[model samples]
Target: MSQLRRILVDAFETEVALRRVFLWLPAAAGAGVVSYMAADREPSLWLLVPLTAAFAGLAFLARGRRLAFFLLCGLCAFFAGDLSAAWRSARVAAPIIDRTTIGVVEGFIEQMDFRRAGARFVLRVHAIEGLAAAATPYRVRLSIHRAPPFEAGAYVRLKARLLPPAHASLPGGYDFAKDAWFARIGGVGNALGRIETAAPPAPPGLALRTMMALDRGRNALARRIDQIVGGDAGAIAAAMVTGKRDLLSDAAKDVIREAGIFHIITISGVQMTLVAAIFFVGFRRLLALSPTLALRYPIKKWSAALAMAGAVFYDVATGSRVGTERALFMTLIMLGAVLLDRQALTMRNLAFAALIVILTEPESIMGASFQLSFAAVAALVAVYEARMAAAAADREDGLILRARAVEGERLRLFWRACKNLLARGPGGLLFATFCATAATASFMAYNFHELSPYVLIGNPLTLTVIEVFAVPGALIGTLLYPLGLDAWVWRYVGLGIDGIMWAAAEIGRLPGATLHLPAFAPWSIIFLTLAMLCSVLWRTAVFRAMALPLAVIGVWGALCGPSFDMAVAPNGEAAAFRGQDGRLAVIASRPSLFASEQWLRADADGRPAREAVKKDACDKVGCVGYLADGRSLSLVFDKAAFAEDCGRADIIVTPLFAPAGCAAGLVIDRDELKETGAITLLFTASGVARRAARTPDEDRPWSPAPRRKWGPSSRPFAASRPTRAASSDLDPSSVARAAGEAPGSVEDEDGDASPLE
Candidate 1:
């Protein structure tokens, strides 16, 4: 019987070795799918999938056991990659029924965007009630008519059509629809009134409502905390507790982004891992304190179980998204290991984690968090296992030489222990962190152009602190949680986090802390991913060393390769060039103050253009030119064009309408000039004719004229073309006044200049 069992075990092992090539097939497929989905111009070569699948199947049949296992790994990786696209597509196609009149909407605000004069938000509406398009709620990314003071939880109703969020018009541009879909947000809008008391209907048979309730409660708590502490500290505290970061102003957000410490506010891997580790350590320590209990049962095992419970709670508290999912999977595996009397950090455990993640949320397969966390774990496991195997071989060789020598056995055990410690020690931890950060950063750079230069420094320091502080704090928090003192402990924890926040902000201020790159190309992302995969897989020392540096350089080159920073004006015209400070500027022939302000605010990092102009005029037409400072733009307009002479505008721009003789410069028709994508002006007659439609021809021509005399600088410039000029040089206060006096008008800036200001 024993011999048969051994034979069967050996046979099973052989079968695994033989069939393993198929495992990687999913990974390969996922990768292919991801590539296909992320394609700027989706290829018509989908027929290649079937061919590849057939080829892979043929290869699997031809390969030996080792090759089969390798193939299996590829398959798994392929499937994981496909998850992003599948989830994204599902979200876009599935529309939540938003009952606009019923005042009920379900979904989350995926992100915020820029609006004309206010702000635009994208909501991934899961379900909506009392709306026209409730069958499958298509997305309705709402542009807030006015700037509403709100955050992710600020529920609102909209009296607008639900339109699909904009897609990437150009290749490799940010896809808003996909982003919103992946986030499960269906629409975006402002609050109907103040967030009145309302109950959003629950999704079918899911814990979404319960999770949302907790989120709302946490949001309330964060609001209260924000009120208690002002500035960054307050924002950090609120972020730590409730994960509400929108409470911070735009300036604060920019500061954090620049500093590269913005991740702390988001519920991320650090938070989940910290909380779990603390629970485990604390519970273990408590059990150990009770000597009798410790002696009777394994304390570490109990501690692991207790820690898992805490992780479960944390998952519930946070809504069990990607971060929570990863933590829960990790905690469960750890607890399972303790229960099963096996090693936690093994390849089997990694497989288990993968299975758990996929089973729980198939959508997570393509998520960066899932890929990064698992990849890092897998790498660590493989490396550790290989080292163990090497040590075992060394010990076996020594045992053969020593022939039952006690000294040799003792030495071997000691060396093994040392090797194990070395694998997980501070240096190893730092290396692991660096690798993970690099991996995640690469992935993000591919998806989002924003990459922090400070990560090289920030990640190590921040992770070290998190590693040191998290286990202890989490233990304390979990211990106190049972004793009804969790809140008090977290308060103190908040204090510690505040210190961390201070340090992060300080370090983030260092030079080279931030680097904004142009959006990545799909092919660049593919190449970067390939580089990482190669670095991870190359087993030879020389090959690995060579690969690592090459990969880094390659990724850097890909990131810094090209730029697409074109800014489009509200009128659907593209801005010609970036302003002096590298900002987009727009020149409007008849700039409505509100419209200019909207474009400026959206184009600017979140500041409005009106404040820089120093005026209140929302007259008929306004000319908005880029000021030298990237932060500000000047508005040029005519007072008579509207009705009231509201004294607002950095400078007024007017056409040169010379009646006595022909104007010195070329005359431009505003509409025709706008079409040329240049700064050209309309003739006095044409300008007056167009004005007649709005006002009456009897009313006066709005263009102010100096006739080379007493008024403002009447430079004889043709209104026929666009001209680029320094903001410091041009003033149009007199041109605005001249437009009201007579039929003649004066040109503002030179022709042939871009209307982009």
Candidate 2:
């Protein structure tokens, strides 16, 4: 077993690899970022800053001993990462919109992202009608549904409905508001009617002007590609060249997603590597034609430099997303290695790129893009390194003719070499596919709640087309566009796009193509990540031994964690209760489409929102539903139903105020939810447990406490009716029974202070 493991797991270690201590810096720094994110409250920099500096200085001083130096350096990286995240959070802090508002909006369009059905515009806001100057947001994003989409740098005035950034739909769900805070977006909304262009209050600044000009140029190219392709094929072709996926048809998107080869359209490692490779080889050959010049100067370094420039150009032309930037940085590092005559394709280069990305964008560590990209690369490199060390693989590649061989023997050798080539053709591609898919499956499931079983069929088919024609076509088209001769290039590229789309559609339609998964505990991914790194990074027996157990623990936790019995939206706009069939059935007076969708996906339920509604006893005043554990839940809309619900139900939830002394086992009201944010309840043999999306206990900047109502104060009014029960009228025995405790069973040291039940 150990011998088999050693062959497959790359235990071939070099002294150089073992001594590269900086390889671990990115991991340590990432750990620090995670620690900061998981904290319930903000960290104090004044207390942490000096301590971090001192620890780093200590690491610097411990240079003589290699082991101690590595340990201390790792600690320093961790501390620096934590401090970096905190500092970034503080620096990006800005005013957030408090409530929904409907009015005219005037702003300069900073960005425009078009979709097939609609477009989203990010604006640098100048004013919102009727809002106080202090309350105006610095920026807002609006979904434009009407025609005549505005371009970047255009000033527009339009009426719209704007809302504050929202919290998670349920506990441990994705937090859009937190992401928006980092992006410096204060609000999001939908625009109404046609957009009206207006004169700018002032000219755009030099930096903004430059960026907008570049965006306009790229968008023009994307549009031209779309025009030539003329269908869903065109949309995909445009995306392949420009990374603008908004124009994709729904069918195309579904097929690509199910096929699990959507990364081809995105500006990721594959795209970057192709562009750089083309430029590097093309320029090197071009330079080498002049032997006199080639011998006098370093043509390889010159090629690498041009390759780096080409990569940077591709990155910016394709929107410069965080994932693309990461790819560009890694590509640049590899090219730089060529210049220095060092081994370019190694783990050390990957580590250096990761470290640079972490220090520059610490917040990016939390994003799915960063995690997925890095994970796939790490797995591929590990497998490649392992294969390189195998003796058989070398012997197969070393097959050649000997000078002493006779005619018949030479013929035999030629056929033998042909057989080896045929055997390697499909085997190598399949192996690489397995390695990348296995490494990214858990994270993909965790993020999208779905997996593609046909990726094995899909990746090989689509990737070939992408490599042979699609990428090269885009590259040629982009380079020749300024000459007005690129239309022919795009027409050929469309044929490759058609092939890819056909493969995606057919493979995606196969039975069991997509598998839905329930959301797992967030910490499970951490364990899984550690397992991957341990198995791939080090060639030692001890590290290899640690990998399997950690992976098992992660998979167990992800698959076996407790599920929510019931859930309520943050603002009490939508609520859901789980039925006996283990499916969520929503119950709400004013339903929220976004919240319902999130809940269904998280629960791994594929039913539509309408079909998923709970068929409970309901009327205008209230509704009653039953839990799997035989508990009755009552939702009261009117104050009239509260009196009856508070008495008969196991739990009472209402927007109206319930009178004191209700005998229900639990009471959840609007005021309570306002403080708790969204919450999920878990019912067990012992009792009921609640998990809130955001509790009063946590004080993160993105999730500030609810603000008080604004306006002039009013005098309190007294109710004349005396029929309802008042405060301090509770019956001790009834309340105790509701709490599942005998009345006055326990004694306290002070008789006057029996703990309030």
Candidate 3:
């Protein structure tokens, strides 16, 4: 306790900017968490407005109490802002509830994603054939079996079957609906036939027109690059330049992901920083060629301004995604600091940039891109700051001169050799790559449930080529496009990119390149993140010790084994049970690739859908099998099958109604599944423990409980009695009464489970 106090006192005295930045971070993070948790509910502005005003007033009155009052006010204001933003987004993109109808849909193409099977795109709906304006969704995603000639901002009409955006495939899986809500996508469907052009390119407003122009430019650039280098390498090059990744094949993507260098394809902080640095250095050197300009003008500031403008243009030209926006904001803040003659890479600058991003798009905080990008930057900055401080202290103490004199010319020569070796050789590059990979590994594992061990070797190998040749060549080619001199540059860039791809492929094929990990519980990620923040934010050596225990606990929690024995889909059509060897064995009567992938990924199983399914037995109704624990489980789709399996199986899963006298220890019929959503079961020595997707407390706008309109019917037959069933039929009432209990009722229900479910 005394050590902690001394460390805190030392930090407070030495680091004002770090202290202020840390003070603001928790408030912003708290607001983001609240916004995410309350995503299913509508926020009330009436209450928010007064709360914000009162907090502001209190903050003003308590200005002298800097630590307490300012932090409280910041928290209140950000909380209100986040709540308001989410509410407005929800109100604007209300889901289309009536999903049974199929009709002609007309909209403008906003985004396109090409898949191996075909192409998928998000359409900004302008009209629907039979639905009124108010009833129609603002946007719908459509998948076509064949690639279309359409591009972004093109108006088109097509006959399609539209439904509400999909729910999570399994309990605690990815929430496509929530993501779609933020993206303003209300419906998803598949096109029935060819898409027909509806109208000429006529965007609604100036902003949209500008966006369309940028899209057109990007498409043009992509096509030119593809023509220059026609293959997977070409596709990856185009994505790196224009942020269009749909052209890359799944195999290509997997290779890059396994190599842990996929971030290169995304136009994030690394790309933006490279672009700005290139421009800054190029312009500064060019201006410095003239002594008059160098002496008379603030050439450094001018270079920074130009770099900022270039970064902004690059961001817009590349679709301005959440990651790009965050990078752009951070770049702008740093450049602005340069213009103002202030420190650029301070913790204060990062904090300000974060505040701006959070205020503008609070939902971004929930994304993996945001988390990973910020974590990398914070780690780099902390390391750089510590190095700079140490260097300054060494210079102040005259240690360098004294050492040089004492060691003489031999030592000086050795020092010079080492300096050159580090600066121009692999040593410095390897060190930097190691630091970056180490900093981002935990975040990647937390978000993706996988880590690439080869990143240590692969990133340095590929990234060196990218930084030296590919990025520069691409940027130069882009600049030379208007002059019709881009082809040669693009060819050179393609050669470098091809080299990167080759390196990634070779590295990815090595043994144990990728390691799949089980999903971490939410609290584990929270604790790990806090620990990272503590380690980076504090300067005192003693204070850094605060993160050690928290980090250990977080890692322990994340590495814990899977809790549930079996998982069932929302519709009871698919299920996965863990075998004795801890491998997931899928039993899906009606196979869905998306659901199957989710189940396998969550189970940390790397096998394909067909290979993952261990028990595929089925007879007319549904499948029946024994779990690893020897527990009998059956899925009955037909009445006769239900009657036969009822008493024989310990657990029965059915899409149809269950008989009243069904004697299964646990029964999940369509009715029970409708209310509970997806379910997971853990078979302990005592009994079975169940986890539901949606609980009673989860009754919000996004996940409303199933409405029960009818009263419960009494048992039609006498209890403790059985009736003879026909060979082809089963009496539900008789079965219910014979069991002497309700059909769906089961004892030893466990409601408190992992929040992941």
Candidate 4:
């Protein structure tokens, strides 16, 4: 009895400590690392080294408790893994000669890329031709043009120009550079006519053929389903089945986006959770039915193993990076628990899973999918564990036992079961969704500087449907596969999804479905994360209550923060060509790329909105009038362009290069004025004002001295502060009069007058 007591006490103690570590330590350490990255001027690796040593010491000192030690080690390892991955990426990226023509390119196609011109593929390059001196080979993204009809599995070789990824000139453009970097894609381009099919055999040991075969089958089924459902239904169904959302139409996608159901587009947590639950329930039932099998072996253990196998198959079929990683990590945990004959929900399992994934691919740790997936799982596990602990504590108090007759005990158990179900199911799902959305929003806001206000509603609905559908669909797909009816099954599934799409579209069309919140401040996300952490970690009711207020404050900050669209000068003088909705508006100055493109992609980072606000031909340099969703924002190339039909111009912006006669009313060119010997003035109307220049005899507080050299091409001088029309009509030599002062005055500077040559 004493031995048993000691074992129970040890198990309980270890479990509690492990819980504290996994549930809380990660957030603490993550905070520290992120803080260090932000605050330190000259980052000291030694600071982390000490922390690393301390973690290692903690692991070693906790002798009998292997789980706690492994967790600490895992946390430290993740930190190290992040640094290593970043370092390696930097090293590999540094040596590659930019614009070098000679490099041996080799890699299989990662995925089929559909472009307007033709079907291309994203090739993962292994080598470059001329730069053999560069030891480490980084992956390059190649766009194969005019490919001989190819599917995702096909392998081809192409000699193409490797250019650096494009950067956003303005704030809101998508940073392909960052995305490509994380994806380990170093270059992107089309084939240069020399293309060949180099169908390489699958690698020796890994599950390449099996994975490919599964992918091919899934794709084939999806295509057939697409054919059956046709159009939007087919696209939605294909996405549901194979996790391929690229086929979805803009209208269908917009509906999903507005409904906050875009999470359904990705097969990760929803599918995995359902898969695990089904296996757990089905296997428990099977064991109950068969006493002989139940007595001999642990049915739950076998169920977990089978569940893992299903997850593996599901991941391969989808090939979503996040899904694959999460499924693999979770499966590893289950498999490890099975081998140890331990409960799968322990802190050790989560740690081991995290360690495996980080050690394999550290870059994934930084991605939104990984962060959100782990956050949801962590939140769920923590919530469940807390409930179990509370129940156990209640039992230990004996107050419940003293009051319980047989009927009373039965009622108590029923109530406790109900509580557990509610806590772990609906409550847990909601909390998990909340945490994930918060974290993702924060990350996106910091990176893209924009927030989709509808996500609060969108994600929950989407995740709920996904959770409802993913498992049932996977199971039905598998069951029907053996009976040669999977295709037929998916055909109906496609039809059902199409109906959902219609509903979502209707929802999107409703008034104010998507509220566009400007990019958030950094501290807003930080405080929000803090509030979320407090809610999860704090035990006292008073402390927990604080989380709500903090969350509200954080959200308020996010909603009313500095917009990335506006470029403000250091002195607080700022300008933006912005729509009333706070989106960038059309300007006469350097054509606003994003303004012209009707569809703007909001980056989560607190950066400028660099994507096109409209998808019109206005992406290029030219005057354009954007008409999308019944709203028009016009731009004129000539000086002082007019919008006849539209309402009064909400905001007028002039590029620095706007013709001398052009009047935009507001000019955003602080840098241009600082660099060039020119001063821009903004007034209520088109006008010219002249102030006498300070002479040497007249003392001035702070003034720039006038300097001059002979004109590069001397011409006859025309003296005057030219009117808009005079300036517009002036010869090149005469235009130089205002700067150096000409001999004769020739024109009038009238206020609010139209500048027509």
Q: How many residue pairs clash in each candidate?
A: 81, 0, 5, 41
lDDT of each: 0.47, 0.74, 0.70, 0.49
TM-score list, all predictions: 0.60, 0.84, 0.86, 0.64
Name the Cα RMSD for model 2. Answer: 9.6
Model 3 Cα lDDT, one tens digit per residue, 276-312: 8888899999999999999999999999999999999
- 324-418 in candidate 1: lDDT tens per residue? 57657766887778878987765555555655565445545555656656665555555676567777886677667577666647777677668
Candidates 3 and 4, the one with greater TM-score: 3
What is the Cα-based TM-score of model 1?
A: 0.60
Candidate 3, lDDT over the whole model: 0.70
Q: Best-fitting candidate, measured by TM-score?
A: 3
Which 10 residues in a row give candidate 4 its minimum summed lDDT? Answer: 745-754
> lDDT, candidate 1, residue 584?
40
Superposed Cα RMSD, model 4:
12.8
Local error of candidate 1 at 137, Å?
A: 2.1
Give the clashing residue pairs of candidate 3, or none. Answer: 660-732, 660-735, 660-736, 661-735, 661-736
Model 3: ten consecutive residues of lowest lDDT:
748-757
